[model samples]
Target: MKATLPRWADLALIPAINLLLAFFFAGLVVLFIGEDPIRAVRILITGSLGSSYGIGFTLYYATTFVFTGLAVAIAFHASLFNIGGEGQAALGGIGVTLVCLTLDHTHWLLTLPLAILGAGLFGAAWAFVPGYLQAKRGSHVVITTIMFNFIASALVVYLLVNVLKVPGSMAPESRNFAAGAHLPFVHEMLAAVGIKVSRTPMNLTSLLALLAAFLTWALIWRTRLGYELRAFGFSEPAAVYAGIDPVRITIVVMLISGAMSGMMALNVVMGYQHRLVLDYVGGAGFVGIAVALMGRSHPVGVVLAAILFGILYQGGAELAFEMPSISREMIVVIQALVILFTGALENLTRVPVERMFARLGGGG
Candidate 1:
């Protein structure tokens, strides 16, 4: 029987069902560990959303995920899997570092925009080579981007150890950025308006993340270029028949994807760490693929998915601390299960739903 679903059902309901199954299995894991799964759920919620401090950290993480998720989504629309978000984000940090080091003595108003431009430009440049190879040289983007991540890691390590390391410091990291380059913490920003939030790594960069999401929606759904990109994604031959240049579209989409991925560095490096540090990307890039999948590559869906992951991260930390039996390794298992069900096993639930819908339609 032919089976179909409304767009909203496909986007929202299928993912929701998959998520529930993931959590149910997660609860089973908790049960096997001799812990009350219900209590664990309670702790998870209370730990992530129960207090201002909790909420602050959650939002902080969600902010970064928003950038990386949107990055993946942008490329997915163009039929590209830009897995080098880690490297692109790291290069973006290099851009931020360069601008901050050169313009540190200036006012924040002067430094912030330049740093953003640097981050975006560096990120776009990093992706351009791969995009060009894919378009012009017939090189596979996946392999090249993955290789770039390792290269980026080695390059950053060399820079930190040999060039940017602070004098007499044992750590392999750059000096703390200047006060002018420091981003205001979310609590501080809130306090300025006579409201108060708990101290956390959350910062003004979250605003940038939100703005990126809105702009991504606009660029994807409300513009002619977006239509061309989607058309190219749907069928390159059809796009070519309609007079769109495949090479140009491919390169442009990757550039935009890289820039969005690079923006994640603004929060991690400039807003929180206040310095160039090793491993700053912290696997947020890889997590973004799952986010984009679960979100159906839509901006609003991406935001919600990001926030869900924020809950998982913050709540998982709390679970690890409160229930010592639930080690970090177990937390990783829980996260892996979520990723598995949502990504690799997504069709497991989808086929059943489709069959159910078919049966319903046939009966009618």
Candidate 2:
């Protein structure tokens, strides 16, 4: 008989244990560098969660990750490896830029939805070609998507430098967006209610991210289409045998994934930066892959995983600043260890856990 675990244990306990192992090894690395690992951890927690400023920044970063994580998770449900989130997000920025620039004089309520629609459509368009290639030509989605990321970077650079650069501006960026296009900062919102928060990028987009997570959860687990997608992921042959069209499903899945990836632009570009700049994505696209893996492609898990990474980001900055001995590269190393443990090495801990549970009257 195949070993199994209860849903909660499989989803929560396993990932938690793996995460602890990652952090334990990360602490050892700090010790190897002659630094007190405990102090480093203390600094990390204090830096990320000790102040309202830190919490605001952490949530801002988490908001972006939520969108990208959902993008990855949606594709994963259909057994599609969408490595093109970077490209899709970049293109989404372009879409947002176009919408904001055109509606610079309009009310934010009108501009925001239009910008969102543009971003989603543009992102979906970017992913459609790769989806087509995969479904029709037998091309590998992973390879195609990765290649598209490079193409996206190049395309954005070209557009910014040659077509979209603001007149008389030296930098490769557009003109500042109009006030009507601005998303209200979280600090301002809180202040309106007599609650003080540090000025940070957290905004309405953060709420949108939360809403997206809930909607994703509903779409994935409570819908018939979600069932089909999951069935396809489990076995394409089985899906086909049940009369589901693989080509159609592949296309639909990629479109949805691309739209989610593109939506990240709203938080970073429209909500925070208020202008289009080169390379604004800053690797959040790839980070979403790690988030999805750690979260097991579930929306709730993705949000929690994204928050953890946000803590790492905010805390890592503190670690680098406070202890010059621990370089920023060390932070990357720590993140990699987390990814390695939770993703590629997950089965190492999971198998043993499953066995232990099996012996304890738990079915696996």
Candidate 3:
């Protein structure tokens, strides 16, 4: 059967409209609170993009989202809803910390590859358990993955408190990475090329995120494994008849997804925090689910959506700080509205758009 809407409309137009609707309603909320929505928007824009400093922070946040967003999108391609990104990312942080600590004397140029490998391995291993259960024991992936998030948290806490934490420290976090283990900041990299920019937490990891996005696109659309995964996602019975193994596909997809999620830790552990911190994932894992939904499960869409969210996050913080009247909680409510419109209420505009397109010869 032909799709009711064209690919362009499905991928771009619908999301654009949904975003506009989300902003419109969010404006209404601002009005109800006796604030000028237009002014609020201007502040958000200025905060997130107006200055080099703000832009740096925005890109940094977007980099983390890119990894998690791709993770969710990959799982979606295999008919899997792997919600263990929070846990996977957490474990990935552990992997990064372990590697960085182990190679404290090495140059960052040398440590990076090892850190990536460690993060991927730990995340993949963490995800393997849930995937194995789902494939071999009929355990639902959603339940297992979600449950693993808490388990991951507990495990990290235990490690930090007992094994990883520096002696005489009160915080439940590992010691800072050595000088050589520190990834260069984005501004430092730019300055090296003679371009002066404001400093922020953003770093070279953003480049890696973009490269990963490209790789994800290639994996999903150009590879045999991707074809098999998509075939299974589209129709399991047909894929099985075509000789695809559900167990293997399920496990492989989960591993890939988990690795992607785990790699997000690089942005925080290596680039920003330089240490293992509690709740470091900061719900980016959950946000990735919304990002994948908004992006229509495409790598490009995920990057774009992740940036949009990056704007909300960095901009929202500025909004609360400057406005004072809006408050941080209000900013969260605004962000929640975006998620609600983009994810839960996504179909609200779809039916009408489909009707219009159908009337205009959308039928194949």
Candidate 4:
């Protein structure tokens, strides 16, 4: 006789297991801090879902995570680790800001698409540099992309503080975007229909984020180029023998991944901040790697995982306010634990106690 689990069951198990482990770890932290873990958990849950404002914030944050997670997932499918999503996103934001600032258009219909296109192009260009280096010179993308991240951060800081500084403000951010360029929240539009809700930052960018995820799924599963990219990922030499050009695939895949990453800025520029700012990406690109890992590089999984993180991010901040002893940074610990459990799930079965139990139960 054989025992089998459905594919959806396996998928469900990952998050269930991850949450169980997270709770266990969070309990330990609560004990160390002399607080009630159950109370803390209750606060986190209730606070995050208690009001319209919380839900709005969660969706707003989710918008960025979805975009960046898809970007990382795309690169992961192609066997590329795009650590420079932070840089690419920042550069894209800068491009969009510059375009909006200079275009001086009265119509949002014209400016919005141009800004998005400009941002995507900027991100693609930034990613292509590392892709070119990796394909042509055999340089390690990990090192080059990390360096690019630092450069991008520094460059954005300089540009915002000095070069693009607004006329009268002392803040480290660009001038507010033109009113026409700002994205209106869905809640506001719905309010016009007599449905009242808290005006959260959720916007059209969220729709774009979902569209990008769908496009990524289609690109990976339905396209000839995607087939070649996956082949190169599995084995470059094998792909070469099959007449696939690894260099071209690498560059194209990276460019596409980077363009997706660049879209992350849509939330900040058009939806939230309405302009570029220092640390606008909010370390989202780095967190995107964890999202990809949690999602196992699947498009739908990435979207789900990104939403989970978004919930934690918005909820954790609220939790800090409700429970003074527990800092908002606790979310980071939860995220790290999720990553650890997913990465080492197989190793957990090898633990001596677990192995002994498995043997006794005939479950191994």
Model 1 alpha-carbon drift over 4 Å, by segment: 362-364
> Taking the tens digit of each residue's C-alpha lDDT, what string does model 3 give over 1-364?
2238888888988888888988998899899999999999999999999999889999999999999999999999988999899999999999999999999788999999999999999999999999999989999999999999999999999999999999999999999999878999989988999999999999989999999999999999999999999999999999999999999999999999999999999999998899998999999999899889899899999999999989999999999988888888887787788788888887898888888877777734
lDDT of 2: 0.93
Question: Who wins the lDDT comparison?
Answer: 2
Cα lDDT of model 1 by residue, 252-361, tens digit = 99999998888888899889998999999999988888889889999999999999999999988999899988887887777788789888998898788888888888
Could you tally the backbone clashes for each prediction?
0, 2, 0, 0
Q: Write the per-residue lDDT of candidate 4 for residues 120-175, one digit (tens) a residue.
A: 99889889999999999998888888999999999999999988889789998888
TM-score of each: 0.97, 0.98, 0.98, 0.91
For candidate 4, the TM-score is 0.91
Q: Mark the regions of model 2 whose C-alpha exceeds 4 Å error after superposition.
A: none
lDDT of 2 by residue, 105-213 (tens): 8888989999999999999999999999999999999999999999999999999999999878889998899988898899999999999879988999999999999
RMSD of every candidate to native, in Å, equals 1.5, 1.1, 1.4, 3.2
Query: Which of the predicted structures, 1 or 3, would earn the higher lDDT when compared with the native?
Result: 3
Model 3 CA deviation exceeding 4 Å by range: 1-3
lDDT against true structure, model 3 = 0.92
